[model samples]
Target: MPIKASTGAAYARVEGIGAAIPSRVVDNHEMTQFIETSDEWIQQRTGIVERRWAAEDETVESLSLEAARNALAHAGVEASDIDAVIVSTVSHLIQTPSLAAIVAAKLGTDGAAAFDIAAACAGFSYGLAQADSLVRSGAARRVLVIGAETLSRITDTSDRATAFLFADGAGAAVVGPSDVPSMGPVVWGSDGDQAHVINMNRTWPEAVESGLPSQLTMQGQAVFRWATGFIADAARRTLDAAGLAPEELDLFVPHQANNRITDSMLRHLKLPDTVTVGRTIRHFGNNSAASIPIALDAMIASGEAKSGDTCLIIGFGAGLVYAGQVITIP
Candidate 1:
């Protein structure tokens, strides 16, 4: 259930932000060494020219830890001050212990309630909503929300549909109680019937029996149709929930799934020239759950956005799940 907005209660604001992308860069031209596609083909379709791939030693845990540290430093908070930790990802190598638990341990956040959410690309927004509820309800004073993924590890390089789309990276935010309102109510849901449009072809057990790699499989056309067909209204509802008009927004940080999807959303929402759109996909590809925060961080770091700016963030992905909300940059 959505938490009702309260003027008399404490709310959550993003006090710190950080992002950690892999060192290696894989450009479209370099991809041709292994795949049959060319740079022109990918650019015209996805607007992605390059993406980062995690090195052999880098794992979800490592990336998340670094991002978390950077966020703590930015927030000027110690690890021990965190009351909870939440991580969102679909590409963690191990399914057990939860990526949140591993990250908490690395940060020395002993006994902090920790867990993971698997809402695909919408995971980060989902986490933010949960953190806001916790803070408003007095269940937690501060929450660490991290979206880290290593899609490259599970991507099938030979699969032309997805090879150029998935990449590796992590982004994080420190959510804490604030005197003024910053985060907005969440608008989120899913359509399971359309799950097949983008998903892994085989379950782990099925992959074992079939002797096939447990790689990501996508139906690009179907996903594009679905995204362009649905996400705009969803974004409008998110803005409405915050009592703000489209023209009032300063930034639009939709999930960095594809440039075309982002452009279609811009057209549908009819955002004014004043609203800065996030274009992280051109270089970062789609980092799934991590895309929104990475884009948010990049925007702040580059001076495209700053304190007190109202931003609308949207996340949509596999399970056909999606979530969006309005927030003020910190």
Candidate 2:
């Protein structure tokens, strides 16, 4: 049986958001050494200027731990208060022990249940929805959701499309209870039918065992097609679910996938540039799941978002998935 709409779920609000970027910076000019694309062409398409790269010694566990610590401090919550830790990622350094488990151990919160969620770029959004549910169900009071990835580790510098598009970064957000519905119902969907549109299969054990090149690859145009229509649909559904209208929004924080895709979705949704916050992918490339929250943190700090301000966070990619939620600052 399907759950009916209009159930009175408890309100779940975001307490804080923190982001971490590796100290290493890789700029566009450096791409000339490996790929045929020029800095200008890449920038015109993806809006990436400089992206962070993990040090060779960096591990997914360490990055998530650092990001989680910053978010916990900003929210004034102790690690012990967290009921669970959810990690969203596609680029963990290893395949076992679950990155979330390792993150909990690092934060001294191992008593909390932890798990990993793989929804590709929509990972953080997926994690947020799960966290919200946990809180509303009285199962958890506080949840830590971190989207961390070292995409550069699997990127083939020779693959022009991927080499210039992916980088490394992490973002964490703490979700807890609040008076009003600070975060709205999320509209999410996945079409495994298009699974190959954005693939990361090279790193599979069998592929590695067979001595095949381990790298990340994507069908840029195919993903662009999915992003444009699916994201617009997600935004519309989220607004409708919240019983809100577009004109009431203060900002829109979208996954920093590509400049062209964002522009297309905005056009399709009839939203003006003023309502959207651009992390300027030209500045950080695509951090995948971390992109939306990274942009949200920037919007809040810049005063584009404030207490009582309403906004939307939408992300889509590599699950062949899309998710959108209307969030209000409290």
Which has the greatest TM-score? Answer: 1
Writing each residue's lDDT as its tens digit, candidate 1 over 97-176 gives 89898789889996799999999999999999998988888888889999999999889998878889999999999999
lDDT of 1 at 84: 98
Which clashing pairs does model 1 show? none
Q: State residue 201's C-alpha deviation in candidate 1, in Å.
A: 1.6
Would you estimate the TM-scores of all the predictions? Answer: 0.96, 0.93
Q: Against the hidden true structure, what lDDT does model 2 obtain?
A: 0.81
lDDT of each: 0.91, 0.81
- In order, what is each prediction's RMSD in angstroms? 3.2, 3.4
lDDT of 1: 0.91
Error of 1 at 257 (Å): 0.5
